[model samples]
Target chain A: MLERVRIVLVNTSLPANIGAAARAMKTMGLAQMVLVAPKIFPSPEADTLSSGATDILAQARVVSSLDEAIAGCRLVIGTSARSRHIPWPLLNPRAAAAQAWAELPVGEVALVFGREDRGLTNDELHKCHYHVHIPTNPDFSSLNLAAAVQVLAYEMRMRSLEDDQVEAPFWGVDWDIDAAPAEDIERLFVHLEQVLVKVDFLDPENPRQLMTRLRRLFLRSRLDTVELNVLRGFLTAIEKSSKQ
Target chain B: MLERVRIVLVNTSLPANIGAAARAMKTMGLAQMVLVAPKIFPSPEADTLSSGATDILAQARVVSSLDEAIAGCRLVIGTSARSRHIPWPLLNPRAAAAQAWAELPVGEVALVFGREDRGLTNDELHKCHYHVHIPTNPDFSSLNLAAAVQVLAYEMRMRSLEDDQVEAPFWGVDWDIDAAPAEDIERLFVHLEQVLVKVDFLDPENPRQLMTRLRRLFLRSRLDTVELNVLRGFLTAIEKSSKQ
Candidate 1:
């Protein structure tokens, strides 16, 4: 599914950014890259910055125009830094990823990135089916070219991973021990209160919400069986020491 | 709220990457940056790469140690590349952002990134209450420092925007107590260990990750100041009972 999505860079000035973009894309499982009228390509600076992702740069397709880059793409999403008055559909990175995945089943999708200084031309943005804007600080909205690529690629990977999952797995359940059952938790609380009273931490006559607060905290954590047993063991040890 | 969340970079080698990281943070509306023992600073390379985000570089706090960097932060999240044997709570960038936001009402929260070459050390990772891992391609998983910052910072921005759009806030700051600071949590651990040994529940010579498991459970709960005091009082009570 990720292979069907191609990253398109239009009129990029720095070859190093292109190399870095390739590295960014590859890190997020994106393979295809299309370069449209970059100022410099096949430069050592790019290869040097690419680190180990030279394979992405090696297979990158260089084209002369934006039309060539998005020729075969069924879904074209252009990254826009500024709000254009065209009133086209605008999506965040995550939403854009979802839209891309939805379109990927039928045909190819292109995530187009514009030049460093200025983003995609008005005409270029018009060609896009959706304009995706990374919500940036209004004052300092200029995002680095590769940084932008990294954010979009990351969203793509996250969306893909979410789709791959059978269901939303509950956290803390994957640990070695099972989550303590309600009965176990109730027993632990009962034992805990007994020890607290014996150790003079809580007065049985007036507990004053101390036990309630503790219960709330522990309940939110959803202690596992091992944690519950550990607590019970500690309580027993405390009880014995107090008696001694 | 965003200002209360900091981006901490430890032992960064290149000044250029630091500058790029500053730019990435500023673009996403995050202002605070703590650099722990970078190799070089105030470099022209970093400034050049930062483009227009020199203010962030100028204001970034350069600390000697990771502890100093995250001194007052209540929530410390480390970026980990590998899946360790220990079953620690791991979150993706989106979930991490949500967690950071949830904790922001109490006090400062930190997002720690490690050295450029090796990433965060095991010891450094253990210090984090939670570990956030970027879902990168396993085959090409190494992301550039600035790129990683970009992804996390972007998520932060997205989360911030989502909250702003909602009519009512997700969580209110009108609570009676703030979350316990990091120093308080540390003190609790120290006191916990002492009582655990005194009661013979934990053999000091063979602790065997017992304290670590306890810390994980408690930290996930984000105990407030009142809860911390109550727990400390209980620990002191246990110690007194054991001596008697």
Candidate 2:
């Protein structure tokens, strides 16, 4: 499954970043790499930048377009630094990696990295099933292209190993049942937030961090279908009773 | 809590690696990086490699010894790839990030990364309360120092984001109990290992992974002081019954 993971670099500006990305991929045991219309490749700069992992750079396929880069991939994910005006389906790097690896047994998965100056265009992102956001500091969020690849590659590689049991995040709440799908969770959040605002518990004008914290708390709970439904039903009752 | 997490680099050889590491740190929102006797600093190579993260390089403190680098930190973790002759408490990068963040409220925490050639020495590892091993390819386990930092720094910073709620790991046992101190946990491991060996449950001659897995399980449980004592008491009883 890990071997089926392809790291695609689109219109990369720096040759060194291309080399570094190859090195990062090799170190994590990923072999497949594809480049789409890079400014310069097959250069000494890339070889020097590859450190000891130049073989990955050598085997890397150079394509003319992003479509060709991900033509055979069953799962296509683009790395995006900024949010769009209308949000697309987004996955944090961890989730995206998990989702990609889960699809790997069926077919190839492409993790697309955009150009250095600007990330993937909206049209390019629209082609992807998900956008992976590598959470960075708001103040200095200009993550080097290879550094971003290093993170996602590391996550994907780690998931293949049994060590993920140790790296799991602390969700605070544990559910014995299967977790609800992301769409169901989103619907629950919207339903609950609407009721809270209706009951004056949340201020729509100046919501501040109430909704954010509530999202964190509920997300941390990892609610199952029954639990989510129960919570939503309780919120509805509160909305009706509060009118009295 | 973010401000309290310190990044300590031990005896780095390459100036470029340091610069790359500084850039990696800044991108992940980590500000504090302490170097213990670096070979070169303030070099043009480091400056060039830092790519726009030179401010972090300018502010990084170079210390004479590892002890001095982490003097004020109450929690110290070292990054190691291979197992020592006798294993120390260890965590995968993700768990170490969560654990370090959890300790931030208590006091300053240190995340130590060693040289590109050789990782932390036994003496240096002794100063650390835990070791964080970033899983890499077994055939080519040689991870570049800056790349390793980027992975860990990314993990630590990502945990601070609200996305942790979705990526949380399973702790297995859930008890609303205070987590025991690292030192107390260390002591418990020592006491438990002695009894396990004395009772022949764990053979000292060929210890294998018995103790290593035990440490991982206990650490994952995040036992409190009372729980540690109760487990120790059970060990003592087992030893007594084995004698009979």
- Every candidate's chain B TM-score: 0.66, 0.66
The C-alpha stretches of model 1 lying farther than 4 A from their native spots are A164-244, B163-244
Task: Give per-residue CA lDDT, model 2, range A1-244, as digits (tens).
Answer: 6878999999999999998888888888899999999999888999888887888888999999887887656457789975775565567888877777766765677899998888888657655656789888878887889989999999998778754465445432243455454456567778888888887888888987676556545544545668888988897888778773
Top-lDDT structure, candidate number: 1
DockQ of candidate 2 is 0.12
Q: What is the C-alpha DockQ of each candidate?
A: 0.13, 0.12
Model 1 residue B8 CA deviation in Å: 0.6
TM-scores of all models?
A: 0.69, 0.67
Tens-digit lDDT track of model 1 for B135-211? 99999998999999999898888888894432211111234566554456667888998888888899978977677
Query: lDDT score of model 2?
Result: 0.78
lDDT per residue (tens digit) for residues B14-55 in model 2 = 999999988888888888989999998879999988878888
Q: Pick the candidate with the highest TM-score.
A: 1
TM-score of model 1 (CA atoms): 0.69
